[model samples]
Every structure is written in structure tokens, then in C-alpha cells.
Target: MVNPGEVPTASVSDLPSQDLVLLDVREPDEWAAGHAPEAVHIPLGELPARAAELAELPDDKPLYVVCRSGGRSARAAMWLNAAGIADAINVAGGMKSWHTEGRPLVGDREGVPPEVL
Candidate 1:
């Protein structure tokens, strides 16, 4: 398990959801461009206000946080951990790695091929 800035992290290989929750903490445009098909989108800017909402998630499950790249997700993960969400982990390389490693992706529009933005 990768760890950065005292927070846990996941990799591209662990993506596409392996019976875990994937949170995409990217902006609306980035999320719209492409993201893990099963990810839960919650823009980083909104995390402060929405942190409480995540408390309802199952504690036994891991919550993998992701962004276009690892930057934002790392901070989000740190914030989440400080917020007492121990299972929150950042996806090391984010969607860039996922797409590069041939992982699945989905766009906001139907029938359109997803592309990382």
C-alpha cells in the first residue's frame, strides 16, 4: 500500500473499484471529461462542506479518493483523514494512470469515448 504525506494511497491497478468506494475529487470539467466509471464525484472545493456526508459511508469499506492526477486527491485524503474518515485514501496517479494503464473510463455524455482532460 502506497502512503504519502502520512495518508494511505491506492494505485491504478487497484482502481475501477474492487468492492470499494472511489471518490473523484476533481472539478466539474475534469470529472465531465473522464473518470472512473464507478467513482463518486465530489469536487475538492466542496469537500469542506460535504465532509459530513461521507460519514454515512460504511466504515468497513475503503474510500479511494482520486482527481485528474494525484495532487488534489492527496490533499483531499489528508483532509478526510483529519476529518476522521480513516479509510479515505488517495489514488496515487489518479485518472491519468488509470487511463494509461487501460482502466475503464466514462464521460458525462452517452456514447462518447471518455478522454482524460
Candidate 2:
């Protein structure tokens, strides 16, 4: 088990999606603005009550947490690790870097293509 507050991290550009589960901890509005199509949404504020929902995700796939930036996701990843999901990883720089790195995103928020909120 990882130490408290010692969640692992990964850069957006180097994220290996095939081996991980992308968990978006951003708020609904931010998520609606733009987010990775394959990511699973679970707002940080709701994590405490909704953590059980994560049990259904494949255990072999480590959870990679993300948000608009890296702050909230770090907290969420730490919480997840504490909750027994030992492999939860915080996606460094979050969606901002993902968008800046030209990663593919899926959302239809007017003329706003794919941008970090």
C-alpha cells in the first residue's frame, strides 16, 4: 500500500491508456467544456459518497486521476489510494497539459473545440 498522500503520478503525454483507467475529477461544468472521451467522470466533491462506484472498474487497470489542472486530481488520487485502490495515479498537469499536448478530446460545447477549463 502507498503511504498516505503519496499517490503516484504520470505525465499526460506519456499516459498509457491501455493499461489504466482515466478518472476525471473535474466539476460537471468543466467536464462539459472539454474532456477525454474515454475518461470516467467523478467530481472531486462527490468522491466521498461515490467512491463505491469505482469498484466496478477493472481491478487490473490502475486509476489515473485528472482535472482542469492537477490540484483536485491529486487529492482525489490520494483519497482513492487511501480507499484501497493502491494503484491510483494523479495525471500531472491534468487536462490543461493534455489539451496543450494536442491529445484527442471529445465534447460539443459550442465553438469551443477541446480546451482545458
Candidate 3:
């Protein structure tokens, strides 16, 4: 198992827009509830199948995976790394940290609309 403390960590403020891809692994319902603007909603379960869609991200640029409170994203990052994406990094605190730090988010509390699917 990947340990969060063993990897390099980045605070929300430390995240660079160009050097990182914020991959949100939360479900559609959670993503629709709110997500960081810099984040891409991939849902943990869908990542393996959707790997091709992430080609825009260079192999060198780190992918910062995040979820509701961090668990899922950490696992997703591990899986991505095993699959050959070397720079996958799990955001330690997930969206909970973002909210704790007062970062702004966009989404509907009711849920992500079906049209966005």
C-alpha cells in the first residue's frame, strides 16, 4: 500500500497550474457537489479505462489525484503509477483540505447534471 506520508506533498497554494494535473477521483455525485477548478473529474473507478483521455498530460508533469477526503485518490495514484504513469501524486487531504483552506470550488450541491455525463 502507498503511504501518504512517504510521498512528496503539496499544499493547495503550492500546486502549480501548468506542472500538475489535478485528477478528481470522486464519484459524479461528489464531483457535482463541488470540485476544484483546476481538477479534472475522472472518478477512481473509471481511470483505467479512460487512461487514453489523459494523454494531454505529459509523462513528466505530475498528476495530483484527489478525492472526498484522500483515501480513494491515494489508491488511484498508486494504480496509475503501476500502470506506467510515473508522476502520479496523491493530494494528501483531498477536497476536505481544499475546503479547510477556503479554496473556491464550482459545482451544484444538488448534483452533476445528467447532461454533463
Candidate 4:
């Protein structure tokens, strides 16, 4: 469990079975390379401005935040939690871990297989 003031984190293997929102904070290029199929992209730098967008997402479920690695997502998760975006949880190890664990990933371009960038 995460202590107060600390962002909660979960590895790909430990993701909850319950439905939840996946938010990707990676850069546009990175996202184009590969990302969780259902994730909503809002690059980390744009999160503050796009805050209202996430408000439209369902709130009953937790939000899983991810980036190239854990660093950005951790900060994003913490900020979202403080900003009342949702009960944010950082996806530890980010896309690297997700790919290594064989979780589904898709790219923006067609006919080109996705890869963690």
C-alpha cells in the first residue's frame, strides 16, 4: 500500500481485474510508437490544461497512469491525486514493463507492429 503523500504503484502483473481508466503521459511520438490500446493520451506537460478532459471519464474506478518508465507516471499520478482527477495509481516500469509482460499494445500507424519507444 502507498503511504500518504506517496503515489500508489502497481506492476503490470498486479493490475486489478476490475475495470479502470488507463492514462498515458508519454510524448506524442512515444505514444505513436506503442501504448495500451484503451489508454487516453494527454502527455504529461499537457495534463494541467487537459484536466477537464479527464473529468468526463468514469470516476467510480481507479486511474492507471503510465509513461515511458515509472518516473513521469509517478509524478502524474501524484499530481492527479492532489488535483482530484481520480484515485490515480502509477503503472510501475511503464511501457517497458507492459511490453515485457506481454500486455496488449497498439501503434498509431497501420500495418506497422507497435513497439515501446
Q: Which stretches of candidate 3 lie over 4 Å from their true place?
A: 1-8, 17-19, 109-117
Best candidate, lDDT-wise?
4
Model 3 root-mean-square deviation: 4.4
Residue 64 CA displacement from its true place in model 1, Å:
0.5
Give one digit per residue, the lDDT tens place, for model 2 in 1-117.
555347688898778856557899998888888889888898999998988888888887788999987888888888888778546889999999998888878875887776667
Local distance difference test, candidate 2: 0.84
In candidate 1, clashing pairs total 0
Q: Pick the candidate with the highest TM-score.
A: 4
Candidate 4 accuracy as lDDT: 0.89
User: Candidate 4, which segments miss by more than 4 Å at Cα?
Assistant: 1-5
- Deviation in Å, model 4, residue 67 alpha carbon: 0.4
**TM-score between model 2 and native:** 0.87
lDDT (tens digit, per residue) of candidate 3 on 1-117: 556555545666667745457888999878887888777788888888898877776666788888877788878878777777657877777888877777667776555431111
Poorest lDDT segment (10 consecutive residues) of candidate 4: 1-10
Best to worst by TM-score, what's the order?
A: 4, 2, 1, 3
Off by over 4 Å in 1: 1-4, 15-17
Model 3 residue 55 distance off true place after TM-score fit, in angstroms: 1.5
Off by over 4 Å in 2: 1-5, 17-19
The global C-alpha lDDT for each of the candidates, from Candidate 1 onward, is 0.83, 0.84, 0.74, 0.89
Candidate 1 local lDDT, 1-117, one digit each (tens): 234568787787865446768889999988888888777888999998887778776778878898888999998888888767657888998889989998788899677778998
Report RMSD (Å) for each prediction in the order shown.
Answer: 3.1, 2.4, 4.4, 2.7
